[model samples]
Target: MHDRFDFLKNISPHHGEVLRNVLSKETRETLAAKLDVMPNGQTWYADIYQKAIYGPMVFRDPELNIIKTIEKLLPNYRILSDLYLEKTPDDQGFPFHTDFDSIGFMEHPEDMLTVWIPLTPVEEAGSGQLSIVMEEGAVRLSLIREANQLHSLVRVVDSSVPAHPPFQITQQEYDYLERTKVTPSLDAGDALLFCNAFFHKSEDVHNGKRSAYIMRLVRKDAKFNKTRLLALKKLGQNLAVVDELLKQHYPDAL
Candidate 1:
């Protein structure tokens, strides 16, 4: 297992301290309240089981400032979208999957990134810790075929899809993955910067609430398909507004 500090190296050194502060208790409490009231406060599940708040990047809230700071630090990356809090019980958690498999954020799959920031301290011994599979190892498994469609960050597939490949694992499988996959412990202020291709999931919440905020970033040069954007808009997902807002921010992209 790698230390949490190793993951920090992936983040821009300029924004590391700022991100740490952004994930603090005060910020989390403030942001959590805003997220709790979003219009689409549900999960869409096709292969996994989980609940979350999605598309927070576009919300009119103080949290956007923190996201902007990260964008400034990583000028090449755009904050595509985000999910607020992820909640589950001791025996329930998401399946192991890559963010790339979920939504085609860019023209090329590799151009996307995600930051998984835990709002609570997670120890190795704790059941609700976030688990990650090493990038090198996950490449060997079959890539997830269909991205679990998320209505908002808060919802997941209501039931597992049998035709889809298994993403969720049993407790035994989790243990086996730990033996082969690198797991890291995280605190409230820490975040994991991972490529969309990295396979990851969370351990079931055995005790306290395990909340995390996930922000998706994409390469600026990548294309955002208008068709998909329109579909999301028709669904009334607030992401359509976010897309327009970002376009206004970077007129060159439009």
Candidate 2:
């Protein structure tokens, strides 16, 4: 049961039109033009599971004006990473990867939250929902930097704590997570807000597609400058220097 105090909370019947309209005119062009390039030879629409457009492009649109709404919703916090549209196709494999991998750039990475708002109807046939390991907000994941072997963007988190047997996890811990894992049934306008350090993955869809507008937030003074981040995106750095870029460009990183 994810209570208000827990990291996972679902709000139903959210602003459906607003959520649907997040893919503004500019975002559509970004996808159609295929301009933005991701690290390690990944483009905006490279993979079926994750077709992400630069979030700033979507939110900056004058018609939507989403930043104001987000600021109102989460007081004392601002958008850490704008918004990215992730469309998980039918039966795609989006394995449990590092949830807070990007948070390391934040001055207070521990104090961060991820908001996932589904754009697809839950009642629709063959809808793939997101599955997450539910836990308390106070929990924080212990991770080690383990480079991906395949030079791919997706990688696993190496925990200092005895991870799952598959990766340092004991039977007891795995059992608890197994009991706590939740795949919430959310509507097109529903939002699932969760914290860092938990394992989350996408399910398989049969007939329909799963799309969500995902955003990260942190305290207003969390040392994130959206304009600067957009500029960094303009720099067009590859994935190899990503860690260095964050550590050097971003202040006070541990």
Candidate 3:
């Protein structure tokens, strides 16, 4: 019954304003301007979800500063990935999913955290906002026991490829999620934090653009399971890179 979603209103309201202003001022030359290339196929903004480039104004010092700031906000966690720039129109959104298909062992899915920072407005039940099911942190611990029983099977299952067979919720599962779901109203600068295991998806953007920057971070106290990493490597995904990236971004975590 405990809700895992934590919404922080205006975590960086001024920073958000500064980002918009800076991007607007340098629109002509900055990659941020490439948003106009909507019909094109090459620019990052053309994609519904683009990974922020490191050299652009929105990404350069600004992103680094945000990373550092987030590090402060989450004192004991390690940054797991770079900023994912999500720019979706009123009609597009993602399906409900977790950070990954499986954690592969007795790891709690809540061990990881994903923070979403909106640059555009997001209203409850409005298009382009996020909808999340309120799941308690304990459910993941319970699921880990189920995962334990399936551990050996994962070692040899050819289909255990990291993303090959997507793990989507069944109708019954979704019904429960829908019953527990809540969509928080968020304006630019607000941050929504949630556990990796929570069932969530973006709402259909109905009015304007829903732009946000999302990234993942892991608890510093968590350790990577070697067996799981090996299982993923068999599937052609080098999960060791996740650890390496974490170390590179937050040396203190190591």
Local accuracy of candidate 3 as per-residue lDDT tens digits, 82-149: 34354445334466655454333214434666777665667555547776655543234324433443
RMSD of 1: 7.6
Top model by lDDT, which number? 1
Candidate 2: RMSD to truth: 8.4
Evaluate all candidate structures by whole-model CA lDDT and list the values in order. 0.55, 0.48, 0.49
Clash count of each predicted structure: 13, 6, 5
Candidate 1: tens digits of C-alpha lDDT, residues 1-254 = 44334433442222112244446577776766776676545546311334455565642455546666666557887776777665556335656766643454344544566677777776665546666655333433413322333222112322342444435546775565566555567777577666565456667776657777777777777676444444444444555543684465544544
Please tell me which model should have the higher lDDT, number 1 or number 3.
1
Q: Give the per-residue lDDT of model 2 (tens digit) for 110-199.
A: 456676766665544357776665454212322222122111112122224343323344566556655666676776655666554456
**Candidate 1 stretches greater than 4 Å from native:** 1-22, 37-40, 45-51, 58-64, 135-137, 140-178, 225-254
Write down the TM-score of every candidate. Answer: 0.65, 0.58, 0.60
Order the candidate numbers by TM-score, best to worst: 1, 3, 2
By TM-score, the better pick of 2 and 3 is 3
